[model samples]
Target: MAAVTAMLEELRDMVPLTAEGAAGRFAVQEWTPEGKSRDGVETSWHKDGIRGWIQKFRSGAVRVSFAVWIRDVDESGCFDALDAVYEQGEQALATFLPGIEHSPLTGHLAEAELTATDKDEFIAAREWTLDERVLTAGVVQQDTDLPVMVVVALEEPAPASA
Candidate 1:
C-alpha cells in the first residue's frame, strides 16, 4: 500500500496552496446551523500537525480542491481522519474550483490563489463530542455559470471510555 507520506506529498504538489495559504485561498465564513452572523473568528491550529490539504487534476481542464482537520492526531481516527479530509477536499474542488462551465476532468484555473482563512474559520465553528463533529463554511469567487462546489466536514476527537 502507498504510505500516507506519499499520498500527502502527492497532494502537496497538486495545488498552489500551502498549509498557511488555506486562510487566503478561500473566503470562508462560519455560521450557526440556524443561520446567524459568525463574525469570522477562527480557532487555533498546531504547527506540524495535519491541518489539511488541497489537490488538483488536469486533463483538458484543471480542478482545485481543499480539505482540512483542526484537531489533535489521537482523538480523530488516525487513517480514517485523513481519508475523510481528503475526500471532503476533493468534493470541495469538484464544486468550487472547476469554474461554472468546467468539469474536474475538464476544468481550468483562471489564476493561482491560496489561503488559510477558511481552515481557521472551520476550526472555530466545529463542536466536538466524541465520535463526530460538525463544521460550517462558505465559498466565494466562483465564475458564474460553472458548477463549482466547496465542502467542509469536521471530525471530533473520540471521547474516552473511562
Candidate 2:
C-alpha cells in the first residue's frame, strides 16, 4: 500500500490526479468526462488533451493510468493514437519503476500487429519483471475521440506466512 500511495504522489507530478484531500488517502470518487477529480477540481480531462487518475481497485491491487483524448480521429490516425497512449503508459510506469525506463518496452502497437479485443477496443501491453512483482504497461483504444488509457498496474505483495 505504501508503494501505491507513493506512486499516486509521483503521478501528481507527471499529470493531474484525484486530490487526496477530497478523494481520501488512496481513493477518488467517480468523475465526469469534462474533468472532475473527487477533489472538486477538474483533474480528469482537458479539452481533448491529457487526462489521468488513480483507478479504483476492488482487490488488493492499485493502478495508475493516464491518456490523451483526441476528438474526431479517423482510421488514418488510429495507430498513431494508440502509440500515443502507449507512450503515456510507458512514461507513467517509468515514474515509479526507474529501472525499466532505460529498457524500452517489448510490445509496441505501431510495430506489432493487433486485433480488436472488444467491439471497438484495441489493446496493447507489455510486462516487466520487477523483483518479486510484475509491472505492466497497457493501452486501450476507443472510437471517435480516441481515449488512450495507459495503465500501470501495481499489485500488493503477498503476505508473509503465519
Candidate 3:
C-alpha cells in the first residue's frame, strides 16, 4: 500500500490530472477504476505475475492503467478537450519513464489506446508494467524463543557515575 500510495503521489505530481484538492481534474485509485464520473480520468493498477520461479523471491510487475474521459458542453469542445488530454497524457507518461526506472518501477510504457469515444466524451487509456521489487503483501515472523540482549549506555557514562 505504501508503494502504491507513493507511486500515485509521484504520478499525480508528474501528470496534470487531479487526485486531491478542490479543483480536481481526475480521480485516481488502486486496484479499481470504478465509481469515478465519466467526465474525469481514472487510474487503476494491478500486479500481474511473470512466469518464473524467481518471481516468488522478488516483487512482480505492476500494470498501471489510466482511463481518461473528457467532457464538454459541446461536441466539438469535447472532442478537442479529449484530444488535448490524450496528447498531454502520452507525453507526461513518456517523460515519467526515467523517474520510474529510478524508483521502484523498472519497465517502460507498454500500451495505450483511446478505448472509447462519444459525442460529449472520450475515453483514452495507457498502461505501463513496472518492475517493483517491494512486497505489497504477506508477512514475516520471528521466533520469540530466541535469546535476547539489551544494552544501555549513557553519554559520558553518566559523568563517570558521579
Ranking 1 against 2 by lDDT, winner: 2
Q: Once model 3 is optimally superposed onto the true structure by TM-score, how far is the C-alpha of residue 148 displaced, in angstroms? A: 56
Model 1 misplacement above 4 A: 1-76, 99-110, 115-162
Alpha-carbon TM-score of each model against the true structure:
0.21, 0.37, 0.25
How many clashing pairs per prediction, in order? Answer: 21, 0, 0
* Residue-level lDDT for 35 in candidate 1: 19
lDDT of 3 by residue, 29-135 (tens): 22333344323433222322111011010122222222111112234445565455446544544443444335543333232332233112322222332222121
Local distance difference test scores for all models: 0.29, 0.40, 0.27
Return the lDDT, model 2, position 77: 61
Give model 2 RMSD, 1 decimal. Answer: 10.1
- What is the descending lDDT order? 2, 1, 3
**Tens digits of lDDT, candidate 1, 58-118:** 2212122222222123244466764454455445544433232232212221322223665
Model 3 regions lying over 4 Å from their true place = 1-78, 107-162
Expressed as tens digits, the lDDT of each residue in 56-162 for candidate 2 is: 33443334444432233345666776566556655644463443343332221122222243223435555544433344545554554654454444323343347
Candidate 2 worst ten-residue window by lDDT: 106-115
